[model samples]
Target chain A: MKKINLLFVLTLGLIFSLSNATFKTQGYQVGDTAIDFSLKNIDGKMVSLQDFAQAKGFVIIFTCNHCPYAIANEDRIIALNKKYAAKGFPVIAINPNDPVAYPDDSYDNMKKRAQEKGFNFPYLLDDTQDIAKTYGATKTPHVYLLDKNRVVKYIGAIDDSPKDAKKAKTSHLANAIDALLAGKTIAVSTTAAIGCGIKWKK
Target chain B: MKKTFFLALLLGLLAQGAHSQTIQTIKIKDLVSHLQKNDDTLRVVNLWATWCAPCVKELPYFEQAHQHFKNQKVKIILTAIEDELPKVQAFAQKRKLQSTLLFLDEDNANDWIPQIEKNWQGEIPVTLFVKQGKREFHSGDFTAEELMTQIEQRLNVSKE
Candidate 1:
């Protein structure tokens, strides 16, 4: 009986270790202080959250040129900047996709798309994919709203309806921003939306 | 007249073959029930979208698995998240997909995503494997060999 008990304990130890081996690190959560990045914008200039000294907060969106979901929210992102840039919370779009895997998301293509779409805000490139990995951005169009101190206020989708703006019942990002501006607690700090996965380099 | 009749018959047969796999639109509740069904079979539910390139790339692997495990108790379900039914139908037809296709019609992803898998960050090409109430969620694309290995492991487990 003692030998059997020992065998069972050994099996349990093996199972626990195997499960831990497969476990992944979830990078950041709401209320975590997000690290600032010095990524290059489309205009060949380095930009960072610290550079926006006048800003009260930021709408740091992890998006790209290739993902259809990102394309769908292009106008909405622009509108967010237009509406909130003067309000001290501007939009900072980041292309976190690997350029090698998706050439459409290359720095040159990003410039072209930004110019063509008349993007009012700075569209930066997460060339090394470090910022995205740190922020735990898994898909295109993932939003991480931060306060002036760079504390992550909200994380996830921009709105309930990601494909269509008219069908959006609740703008999670907008609502969070409004609550932050008013010094009220954000009703929903996180959300999820189906989107194209970020292509990591092989 | 005979030629025309034969042509019509051929077209009918072709249409039947083309539509052998039809896309069904279901709410999250329906999907949850299906997942919770008490059965000994291994269900490979892959959540994908038409616009996602990686999802499209990994679809053939699922189809291959379906073909290989057709006689076994293994079922492959290709579920589309936040996509239009017509587009999914057209894409399935174009690709000649053989696996069962499902259009997850629910739009509130934040609510349903956790229901499917608590850790799924709403990324496309994530696959869920269910067997005898036990479940395993894979959050990224899979190669053919990798998928086959997973299915084989699950099948062996069910036998035991």
Candidate 2:
């Protein structure tokens, strides 16, 4: 009886510690090596981080069609990819919202929106929402800039302004990329832009 | 006869619409100062948006609590962030949101997110429940039963 009780307590302790460890590994921070995912693009193709073989890094943005903030930054995101895709940094947008909660965010709608908005980059679908969870994307238009080695060089907003891009005082994402190209340290790494929170799976 | 019934229904709908008041836009500093009262009442500040599905889903819970705990010194305020006023006004009328409505009149989320709570990463459907002696934060949706349990637990703790 005594031995059994002792074993039970030891097992409980291990379970508690393991659960705590799982909570601690919820998401990524700066300098963390990001895990690659194979999500479906709007083109009916499976796209992964490793697919960009010749690229230097990626600009992973969690955005959707419904969110106004995402819609506001749509043009800016396209411009980023157009200017930077050949420069070795390509933009990869992922829609993490569950279609059940938001029918507009369905894969079909994603394709339509991409076409309507004239997206220059791959707008992927995180059907499982695992990528968004692991990346710790809290809001729509959240950005994570990666380097050649897939290390998260910078994270957070695209610019200081979300409501008005042309009136933005500073372009944080662009500045970060410029510094990376120049082999210099990024000055302002993370910034927060007011945006619609990413719609989570129920 | 049918036209008269339709006119009556429209009048009733308009009467119902009168209950949906416009949300006040308050600065973060003003909001914080408003929430800074030293009274023993429990202030429940819910951070939400008009477009947030989860926030909309959980709104009824806060509304129900607002009614059930009215005499218990619990005040509920629904604060919207980054949404168009007209859209939110329509939604407010459609949903018949009973909790006091307000909009956080500030941009630069990084600047104000920390002001609301240091650990908050600008997620919607976050509730800040506080009494004079104790404070608790809850993130995501909550059922009315769960919300009441939490409030009761806090009230009990603060009493002790």
Candidate 3:
């Protein structure tokens, strides 16, 4: 009877562990409360969503230096921060790529890129990639817009045209923010675009 | 005499161009139609781009699969999501890629990305395996062994 009980307990533990792994991989969905992360910023200071007390929301973008798609959207990311930071939704960029696989996406390079681009936002490093995993950011230039309460209002690409901003027909991220600020329902809360996959550490 | 020589040279150049594989530029609708085609052939559609390093690295695996499955009904299509034709053409020529090459000419990825796979978040190195009416979308890079195993498993599934 003791052996049977031990076996039953082990089996239950195994099932729970398996389910937990699945849940983590699925990451956040729209309306889900996003967990704040303390990632090291380019300025060598730790930053988190909770730090912005006065802000109405946050625009968290997972982007890297090596990706062409990310590079193309660099200007637009700056523009987003310039146009909306005062509106209470500031852009916070994160480099989630593994430095081992992509050396260009290393912390030092991220800092260099941020400085060169004259980023008007905080460029942070997800060294352990935990934040990216939790947010379910699969590719560079992936966006996750969260409300002041930390509820994820939007996820996916910044806009329709990732390669060329001039050719973009729709601004999904901006639209979601506008809707949220206006206290209206976001029509297109989620979108996807082609981008370089996040280089996971092997 | 000079005109004849120039004409001969032009013909030779044209013949050379014809011999080399040219990538066909296609719209999202064309791709959808291809995917919707009801056929026994297992269409292994690899969505990639020239600038994506991982995509470039894993391309040889698809090329090898294309060569290996030459006699079989397995079709390997390397669809590039690049706008510049010259770059894709040059890369294909330089690499000597043997798979069926195609260039997705659509700009609005948010519009057409869902058409390919609803859950796809527009990441490169994604592959779409289609046979009959069944479809399987695999995101991320694949090793040669893993690529072969996946193809073999799908082929076997189609047989049954």
Among the numbered candidates, top DockQ falls to 1
Instruction: Residues B68-101, candidate 2: write the lDDT tens digits.
Output: 9877877888888867677778888888877789
Runs in model 3 lying further than 4 Å from the true structure: A1-25, B1-20, B158-160
How displaced is residue A95 in candidate 2, in Å? 1.3
TM-score rank order:
1, 3, 2
CAPRI band for model 2: acceptable
Alpha carbon deviation, residue B65, candidate 3 (Å):
1.2
Q: With candidate 1 superimposed using the best TM-score fit, by how many Å does residue B91's alpha carbon deviate from the native?
A: 2.0
lDDT at B28 for candidate 1? 93
The candidate that wins on TM-score is 1
Clash pairs, candidate 1, are: none
Which lDDT tens digits does candidate 3 get at residues B1-160? 9999999999997666554367889999999887886789999999988889999999999989988999999999999985588899989988877788999998777789999988778877888888887787887888999899889987898668
List model 1 lDDT by residue over B1-160, tens digit each.
9999999999997886676387888999988876876688899999988888888899999999999999999899999887888888889988888898888888778899989877667878788888878777777788899899989988897567
DockQ, every prediction? 0.53, 0.26, 0.39
Model 2 ranges with Cα > 4 A deviation: A1-25, B1-24, B34-39, B84-98, B133-135
Instruction: State how far residue B63 of model 3 sits from its true place (Å).
Output: 1.0
DockQ of 1: 0.53
Isolated chain A TM-score, each model? 0.89, 0.88, 0.89
Candidate 1 CAPRI classification by DockQ: medium
lDDT of 3 by residue, A77-155 (tens): 9999999999999999999999998999999998899889999999999999999998999999999999999999999
